[model samples]
Target chain A: MQQDAARLKVTHEGDIVQVEFTSRKILDEANIAEIGDQLSALVEAEHRPRLVISFAGVDHLSSAALGTLITINNKVKNRDGQLRLCNINPQIFEVFLITKLNTLFHIYPTIKEALESLRSGAQTGRLQ
Target chain B: MRPVFARVVTGTLMKHLKLQAGSRGRRESREKSVGLWCSEEFPSQMAEGRRVEEKILSQCRKYAYGQRDLFALKLALEEAICNAIRHGNKSTPNKHVRVKYRITRERIDVMVEDEGSGFDPAVLPDPTADQNLERACGRGVLLMRAYMNNVVFNSVGNSVMLTKFNESYSSSDTPINSTTVAFG
Candidate 1:
């Protein structure tokens, strides 16, 4: 197969990196691996990375994708960074709830809230 | 009426076996009872796995399955096929994963088998556990059971069967309490 195109759209706002997925479904193994690598690179570039991942248009994702997110979360934590997820659709959010990942990651309903939470150093709008 | 089976082999090592039952006189009854049945075998490649998954999902779309049902099946199918390819087959060059499924208006049943030594699902650590929450893997089976109506493993653990009832979307809304696992 040919090489995968960039899967993430990354933009930097001050010290925070805002990322979005170009593909609506992140279920493919190769694509997930590529996304993981890209996210890792971003995390490594910052002394204390502050990232917000928006799942605005993503319709589907697999356990492998979730695993990648968790790995990214760990990398950020190790560097004393922060990661926030926002705009997750109801179905996907239920996936988090089922795995109890809703409690592990800081999730917000909008990118504004996530950015604010990161800037304020205070978590908010976490789903119960 | 007896069931008729037709098999077709493609260049990509994908084999499709379609089944239909009934005589000309019993067509209506057969349509009601048999629905659609398909079995396929493909190489242990993610692209091949996805091709087969889309075929199955297209059938669901043809039947006008609800959005929630589509989401549930899509998630469950991805996990099942991924597990079979990556873990069961270990991504061996020549290893193949076989998918057999039956779809009716009321429910869908899928079985995925791989050519490798299987592991016991009972021993998998709970990904939701605090100690394991940060772990980067092992949530596939949990998500499968959560989305599908039933998930069963074979006695040797190499094959798993997943079932979901079409009109039973309410069950998926229930909070995760316990998973139903059976060995056959």
Candidate 2:
């Protein structure tokens, strides 16, 4: 489940589209757009709309990557779907905690926790 | 010989102190530093650092492990290597980069040399200035000066010589830096 160049693997189950971010350097202003645009196109093409990003492989996320995910989350909400993050590595999760983006996004422990919430009709703390 | 001619010759000779900067970074075991040579044009710059830096770190750590100088040594070396790739060679594959590490009892010296004709290192604008604040570049020079005890550009700036004073013997007074320059 490796995609050739962008260093991410995407998998889908029902309406939930999973995106995993991977790169050697900490995500910052430099290469964030290269990953963001790819995710954007995948979102626009898929009508089902739910997104669960498995952030296990990411080492660090700068402000730019955090903002990109936030923008995508807004777009998903406007479409009446959900955007969540799962399997966040502890290092990157600490970065999110430091930035307080953890307060904004619905973060779950696993992909199943994120997807099952969508299917069961209960909510996970109302997106923050 | 005139006193001024003798004086001129004496001072010019004295500045480049022969503090014995020879011997490889290896302690007695003599394993060469890794990920350091012929890797300027790799597909990813950070990837190159991760591959080489770990090996270089391990080589030094075997001898100088837990010596407080490890992190700064690793960071400054990577930044210098990265700067050689980005600023020196401009990421061009044709150019070659050579990195050599020499560890003396009192200091560790890391030299990064590039094939390109070097620039005047002094002319580089301060990166912390307003216009350059957001730039991803120029931060390496700052880190090198901060981490290394003395940094010198040699062989016409084609190479950077960075030396970190060993922790145990390094003094706050810095006896080598106390000389005053007097010009009327």
Choose the strongest candidate by lDDT: 1
lDDT of 2 by residue, B1-184 (tens): 1111101123332233222111222232122211112122232244554455565567666556444566567657766776676677777765656665544434555667766677777988775565544343455566577657777777477678776765755433322231111110
Return the interface RMSD of the candidates, in order shown, one decimal each: 0.6, 8.9
- lDDT string for model 1 (B136-164, tens) is 99998999989888888887989999887
The 10-residue segment of model 1 chain A with minimum total lDDT is: A1-10
* CA lDDT scores, all candidates in order: 0.81, 0.58
User: Could you tell me the lDDT of residue B63 within candidate 2?
Assistant: 55
Give the residue spans of candidate 2 off by over 4 A.
Answer: A1-128, B1-51, B104-106, B168-184
When summed lDDT is taken over every stretch of 10 residues in candidate 2 chain A, the lowest stretch is A24-33
Collision pairs in model 1: none
